[model samples]
Target: MQSFRERLQAFNKCVCDGARLMVGQGDYGTYVAHIAKTHPDQAPMTEREFFRNRENARFGVGNSSGFRCC
Candidate 1:
């Protein structure tokens, strides 16, 4: 059984990670793990490309992409 402090720490980490994801912060460790398991023969994208690709997928290309205020 985990102690209260340990559980609290875990919960805090989960919340922080969730917030980061919500704001488009990519998880490189998980990405690497996935690539290692599913595409061992292929090279993974560099960290910069990973984040850029994520942003492109989330928002998209051009001036119309993302939030706009008039």
Candidate 2:
């Protein structure tokens, strides 16, 4: 039996996660969970590294021109 506060917190997390997905962002905590569950022998990246990798993936690698054009 979950307490009211716990239920509310879970609901809040779901809402926030949905909004984040709508904005093309990945949750670091979810990434950690996946790595833990699927690859017990592997290590997950730190939060900063995760975001940097995500950014690089989304915007392509920067070039000598200093900008990424689609």
C-alpha local distance difference test of each model: 0.80, 0.83
Question: What is the C-alpha lDDT profile of model 2 across 25-64, one tens digit per residue?
Answer: 6899999999999999999999999888877755666655
TM-score of each: 0.65, 0.65
Q: After superposition, how far is residue 69 of candidate 2 from its true place, in Å?
A: 10
Clashes of each: 0, 0
Clashing pairs in 2: none
Q: Write the per-residue lDDT of candidate 1 for residues 1-70, one digit (tens) a residue.
A: 9999999999998898888698777687789899999999999999999988777666654556554332
The positional error of residue 41 in candidate 2, measured at the CA in angstroms, is 2.4
